[model samples]
Target: MQHYQVKSVDTKHFRLTQADTEIGELEYDSWFSFTAEIMLADRTRYAIQPKGFWGTTIEIKD
Candidate 1:
């Protein structure tokens, strides 16, 4: 198994990396919303959003 790290580039942007290599990135649409886009190194993309008011559950779509 490999370990990954989530590094915050700013308040709304982040990168997922392993062994100093970037695997993916996450960017939030807004400060108050959990809706965002995910882009992987392989070019795969996904959209994620909160399912409920408290955002305890997340819904991910490709």
Candidate 2:
């Protein structure tokens, strides 16, 4: 099985890291509709779904 790490997501691009290198990136915002998003006080307890589909995974680089 192959795993992917989701680094950053914004209005521009979604950065992915793998094997200590940038593996892939995607520029899109059409698959999900989410709102009421608030800034996390502690950015250490939340994991999000990456933009990848079909049995893909994402992780943080902290």
Candidate 3:
């Protein structure tokens, strides 16, 4: 079975980590934008979508 492997938790956010690397996060209903690493294939990082309110849609840049 699959589970949300929580690596860290805090008042503002929580992280889901696997294989000693961060895979995803939950920012307490905050905004986020997709971030893909240049070197890592099939891996991406999602940062707190800057300067926006909750439920804001952010466009991704490649």
Q: Looking at model 3, which ten-residue stretch has the lowest summed lDDT?
A: 31-40
lDDT per residue (tens digit) for residues 31-62 in model 2: 45321122232433233344456425544322
Question: What are the per-residue Cα lDDT tens digits for candidate 3 across 1-62?
Answer: 65546643655455666665766665544223332222222465444332346545554334
In TM-score terms, candidate 3 sits at 0.35
lDDT of each: 0.93, 0.46, 0.46
Query: Candidate 2's C-alpha lDDT?
Result: 0.46
TM-score per prediction, in order, is 0.87, 0.35, 0.35
lDDT of 2 at 39: 24
lDDT score, candidate 2, position 47: 32
Over 3-55, each residue of candidate 1 has an lDDT whose tens digit, in order, gives 99999999889999999999999999987778999999999999998998789
**Candidate 3 global Cα RMSD:** 7.1
| Ordered list by TM-score, greatest first | 1, 2, 3
Question: Which candidate leads the pack in lDDT?
Answer: 1
Check candidate 2 and list the clashing pairs: none
lDDT of 3 at 46: 40
Off by over 4 Å in 1: none
